[model samples]
Target: MFSGGGSHACFRDCVEGVAMTCTYNFTITASTAMSYLCGDCPNNVSACSNPSCIAAGGIVRPVTVVNNRIPGPGIQVN
Candidate 1:
């Protein structure tokens, strides 16, 4: 859920200028490709004041299947 500061900052500034608080909604896709981009935050190049809000990991494991009907050699879920 990373938002570009350009539009967001402008919107926020506009709303705040009117003495109102702005509510922003965002969605983040957790995938390998988005690994470098932190979730719910701006680009890494730009410093995020509240760094704790960003997602820590973006890696997803591939589903494993053994043979045709059985689980893999060491596959176990608890």
Candidate 2:
């Protein structure tokens, strides 16, 4: 997954061939944001100082990546 946020993360169980084409987009006004794939996420995530932070409190939500099995055999298997 791809994010326009300050930071991002990605975990690959198997990133072969066309799997790389898969992408996700997100917008974060927060100063610090995180992305996790396969549940592997950072321990700390800093919240934004913008007005949005005040409204939602000092809590930044990390983006989660859920990958489904590809219909066809992946490069690794092939």
Candidate 3:
């Protein structure tokens, strides 16, 4: 089990053929702005530092994510 910086509970390594249960909780919040490295703008590494950079195509649009991660966490079961 993995946590993306949020509260979570998980169970793993259960005995084979045994019954087990796993539970997870997530918080939903409004979208937030985030900056990512721009491959094409190597000369302008600080472009995303400005809040308005998103409007100028220097940053990605605000988005809602789980545990502050785009794809969230992963779980495995046996």
Candidate 3 lDDT over 1-78, as tens digits, reads 335333433445667687766666665544544444333342465654443223233345676655444455665553
Query: lDDT for every model?
Result: 0.33, 0.30, 0.48
Q: After superposition, how far is residue 61 of candidate 2 from its true place, in Å?
A: 16
Once model 2 is optimally superposed onto the true structure by TM-score, how far is the C-alpha of residue 55 displaced, in angstroms?
A: 8.8
Error of 3 at 74 (Å): 1.6
Better of 1 and 2 by TM-score: 1
Mark the regions of model 2 whose C-alpha exceeds 4 Å error after superposition: 1-12, 15-19, 30-78
> Worst 10-residue stretch by lDDT in candidate 3?
49-58
Show model 1 residue runs off by greater than 4 Å.
1-3, 9-17, 34-78
lDDT of 2 by residue, 1-50 (tens): 32322332333455556454444533333232332221222232333222
Q: How do these models rank on TM-score, best leading?
A: 3, 1, 2
Residue-level lDDT of model 1, residues 1-78, one tens digit each, is 334344444343333345544454433333332223335334453433333332333233332223211122232111
